[model samples]
Target: MKQLRANREKGMTLVELLAALVLVSLVVILINSVFLFTEKNADSLSKETDVQQNLLLGMKVLTKDVRSTDGEQVTVEKNRLLLGSDEYAAKNGQLLKNGQPVAGDIQSFEVCRPPKGAVYREDELACKPLIAGEADENRIIVILEGTANRAGKSRRLSAMINMER
Candidate 1:
């Protein structure tokens, strides 16, 4: 007597195999894209941080000197500021006199004319005429413009130096 035998298949069909391969490939591609985007964002953030730090440091140093400008003659010309004291002179001017600083018997300060394309605005006190006029008891305003990067982001920082006697 002959017995009939049934065939059993235990493997996936070609279509199912192809579908799984495609899904896995898509997931891998999506993950890679996310990583790339994150990396780019991190790099941009770093650049911005660096720029901010530089600007802040510049402002702090300038502010300290301005606040300590006691008995110092303050001169403002366009974008420059000069603070002169008997001991030392602080200058932020465009032209240095005689390759040496312009000296004064008392403490003196000077700010150089700002470079072209730099924006500046002074307070009423700071803009007072340097002639035969009583010095105003108000503080001087000094605003400095920071260099912009390729991203077109710019920063402006200001310092106020009291001209109080």
Candidate 2:
């Protein structure tokens, strides 16, 4: 009887083996779920596409406005730009040109004149009037900043426009 008892103790019970198997399976399932959840949340490619689309739409409109402008009395501002008769501004989650919303999901539009007064020309130095009473300028950089509506990814795009008379 003692020998038989020792042999039984050396072998694992059926219940013990089943319980171990169940625990391992459960642990594997839990780990897989965690990884899937993390991957879903961290997906950034879709967000990048959204931001790119917004940028393209905004840039298209801005390009047309910049190109069609008469290029006379150009005015550059932080949030607004005046080229010929067309005007662009950043307002209310949209890009506005001539008081009409041209692009949506745009957070900001900036029209900056690079400080090239010394480089552009001595007379046109750094925000100084090119010619008193004359507002026509040469070139400017337009920047559009936006975010994806769903993913919330923020991006910026810029273009340099050489004003033509």
Candidate 3:
């Protein structure tokens, strides 16, 4: 009995080797799953960020044009807003300025003059932009929406632009 015990202590049995292998295999599987999950989340976040960037780019250009133009020269149409010599139009998933692309991946662009006693809110905008006639010489509302990507993210930016006389 003493001799058998001494021999057993010198080397691991087949059962022990199998148990160790099983433990190592389980740990590897857990690590792989975590890595895969993080990669997927990162990819999703990148796409969402791209959508927001497109919206911001379009918004910045619109605000600049509106602020610089004389209100009389501004014209609002369906998916089109013109400020003096600068033209902004939403067509084919892009925002065009002077017949050149200014922002891509744009889903929609809306511009309108606020009504008398109109209240602006982050969640909703209530105004109908006139296609013809003199625009309000003071302010106009602009809204931009981005195209949905693989992340299925949607973003919107709205602003009440005050024209510089």
Candidate 4:
């Protein structure tokens, strides 16, 4: 029987092992940093998307309501909008529709009379936006302006609706 003799010691040396460990740690650290940055970016993007969706939903609801009712039925007060039996108001930094919360983080909600080029005043509220030209009186249109915010950023929404009695 022939036996093989060991030529030299095998396996990784201490320095080689240490170098491998350092390389692995660096890769791990880089991956961790990238994931951390991605997480932060995703969080911010989620907040922004939420605010935008809320603003769009709010505008849609307002438009539907305005279109269903005549201008004479909707009243624009200081910080509230009355549409027939329903009311949309801003209170406690929230927007409410008929006393129920419809949106959050609302900075402002206003009803504007574009034809008059002015916001509706509590004392000067009108059924139809006063226009200089002699236009159709059967249809009246109004504007709803709103602002929604999340974190430190904000978004604005504007909707114009025309109603015919």
lDDT of 3 by residue, 43-154 (tens): 9888778878888988887788777777789987656788887889888988899889988888888877776456668677645754444445477778888887674766
Candidate 1 lDDT, 64-139, residue by residue in tens:
6556776346555554455663222234421223234432111123333233232345432133244333433345
Q: Evaluated with TM-score, which candidate comes out highest?
A: 3
Per-candidate Cα lDDT values, in order, are 0.49, 0.72, 0.80, 0.64
- Candidate 2 lDDT over residue span 87-124, tens digit each: 78878888888889877778777776664443454233
Runs of candidate 4 with Cα error greater than 4 angstroms are 1-9, 117-151
lDDT of 1: 0.49
lDDT tens digits, residue span 1-165, model 4: 123334344577899999999999999999999999999989877777776776677777777877888778877554677888999877765678988888765677766444533444434433453445544333333323334323555666654455654
Clashes of each: 25, 1, 0, 0
**Once model 4 is optimally superposed onto the true structure by TM-score, how far is the C-alpha of residue 136 displaced, in angstroms?**
12
State how far residue 99 of model 1 sits from its true place (Å): 12
Per-model TM values vs. the true structure: 0.53, 0.61, 0.79, 0.68
Best to worst by lDDT, what's the order? 3, 2, 4, 1
Name the lDDT of candidate 2.
0.72
Query: lDDT score, residue 80, model 1?
Result: 49
